[model samples]
Target: MTHIELSVLIPAHNEAGNLPALLDEIALALSGITPVITPVINYEVLVMDDGSSDDTWSLLVQRAQHDKHLRPLRHSHSAGQSTSVWQAAQLARGTWLATLDGDGQNDPADIPALMQAAIDEDAVLVGGHRVVRQDTKLKLLSSRIANNIRRRLLDDDSPDSGCGIKVIRRDAFLSLPYFDHMHRFLPALIHAQGGKCLARPVNHRERGTGQSHYGLGNRLWVGIVDLMGVMWLKRRSRLPALVTGIEDSELLRGESEAVTQAHEESVAAHVVSSRMEALKG
Candidate 1:
């Protein structure tokens, strides 16, 4: 069995028109990556079709037949983007997960950079900051207001929390508390878990096809309630005390090297064990 290092997850709803090119771009962006940046470059693209009425799921099915890395998941009824991503994360077979917006505004070309940043900075989550946003005046204004309000309240230090491009450790992400709109508060949630998160500048493009799934109502009003919930969660968070004077104490040095090595070895061993179990079956 091949070991996967990264899983690029796309939580899409009615995004058939945008996925073909987006998938190609993800393939191209990931192809150039080598082990120099990470322990392994093997990756998968997991697209979650959240009950789209269009050809999204069919397109993924056809693409996955030809593209070995493409993995498609679906929902019979429309679950929100957060639900799509949460479900996909549980099924991901990679050590790391990179999320991209299905709308194509979040550039696939920036993924490698974000992945690299996550490694370099020792961050569990690396969020993309769209320095120059390409949206209408209304969207820009609404996003700005929302972002500012969230920053003041949550203080997650993310410049663009709405930017749908981020690289996160799969284990770390799974450890976070699940909620309806948890995707919007990733940085804060990571912080609540005593994990580090970094923000890096990334490219953002105008939507070429299909309508955006978000608007002021969903993006702002609903988010306000979610923000309060996250704040409550953060206040209640309590990290485990670090143990010392033992073999695991070695991990306390150098960005938790011992811990990372143990995790990698565990994942590899699990893969081999699964393969052996399959043979037995």
Candidate 2:
């Protein structure tokens, strides 16, 4: 099988009514962009049904049968959105991964733009900033408060962390430590690994079906705790060392002691230089 260039993972929870429309929208969005592969742009859409009580899994199965690009994975029990995303990433064969909520609030049309931004910035993570969030007043307020607190604490500069539409490199994402609500800390996490993160404005829409799974109180209270966890992670992050020198080895045991001493001196000098530069910085 050919490797997919992009894997779009949508985590669904009781979203049977929204799956068909979401799939159609994604099809339309992907139709315009040329994939990394020629003739057939190698792309796949994986919908993870997180133990939805509704007919969401059935709908996904039906879609997958007709559409080769559509693949469905299911959890036996309800897993949070972060867990669902992690599960999809494990199954994905794409070099790049795009994620969106399955509630139909995130517009698929914005996906191409996010992909473009990722390319332009050479970013490992490209987050969507909702231009006009079509959510309830309470939801908007809660998100604003959360974003503000997160920006201040993490200094990630992302305007809208809650936006569900995002594009990220698979390897970079996989390298980051996983947590329950890691999705909300992508910008900070990516930056901690020396990866660039760019945020671009995208379209957001009101839900056409089923009520939102999140609410203001849960977001404000639960999100505060998650933010604190992210801060602790940031403090513990450290930059990797770049090895500058190696000691030469003599193959012959009969080699003069002077030769070994010279090599050892050279290695010590290199280590001292590296330490000096690090101290200077």
Candidate 3:
């Protein structure tokens, strides 16, 4: 019943260690404790427990009881992060949507900054580019390579598509074509809709707990296939801009008549000039 302007979406799978602290940090950030920001951010934290085989669901239910801002949704089976996000988008009631990793590597503090960027730039999608990556060298290398490839191929101009922190206008996000890993291709997808994708450099933290559900192979090969698929979609996609207003139509008609009248007058003047020349001759 508390008015929700922003929906903070976190997709988790066996992320019991991260959620408690992440929720608290989000509360602190939204609590208006930061003197730089006003305490006007109204939001709800919707955690999609993606079929956690652990006590993640139980912990979330317990936490939800005490935290009025928290909302817990569960899937009976383990669905991937992309599915969780797509489903959460359908259920989100906020005017704006913000998504961050459940692993807590993405700072909740950055949410406010991204939200401001979303408003400032009139952004349909605001993606966080991690400035400092606190991960293994392997992860850093893989992510760098992936991002370069994605940017070059898609021409989306996004430096960090894999960064889990992104803010978007909920309606705009829902308008995009959905697929299994559509989360990774949001910038390009939004671009296809003639929507703006704003990028903000944000803080990235090291994972305190929970191993990555993704392996190196999961990060690279599958992404390539998905990237190719999205490229195909971009080639095939076209959106129509339709406006229905009698005033606009009438204005267009009036402009057309004016042009026609001017052309007719020019033709008449040319004929009169020719007749005058003939008479003189």
TM-scores, in order shown? 0.83, 0.82, 0.83
Q: What does candidate 3's lDDT look like per residue over 1-281, in tens digits?
A: 44567889899999999989999999987888892245677778889888798889999989988998887887766667886786677667677789988999999898888888878877788999988888888788777787788989988798888889999877777677656677889988888777788888999998979798876688877788677777777776575422223433222211120113344345346545643543343
| lDDT for 245 (candidate 3) | 32
Off-target runs (Cα >4 Å) in candidate 1 are: 33-40, 239-281
Q: Give the TM-score comparing model 3 with the true structure, all chains together.
A: 0.83
Please report, in order, the local distance difference test score of every candidate based on alpha carbons. Answer: 0.78, 0.77, 0.78
lDDT of 2 by residue, 1-281 (tens): 55567889999999998989999998877875553323344678989888799999888888778998997887776767887787688667777799999999999877777877888777888899988889899988888889888888888787887788999987777777666667888888888777788999888888979999899667887888778777766675574422222322221111221113344345346545643543443
Q: Model 3 clash pairs?
A: none
Candidate 1 has an lDDT of 0.78
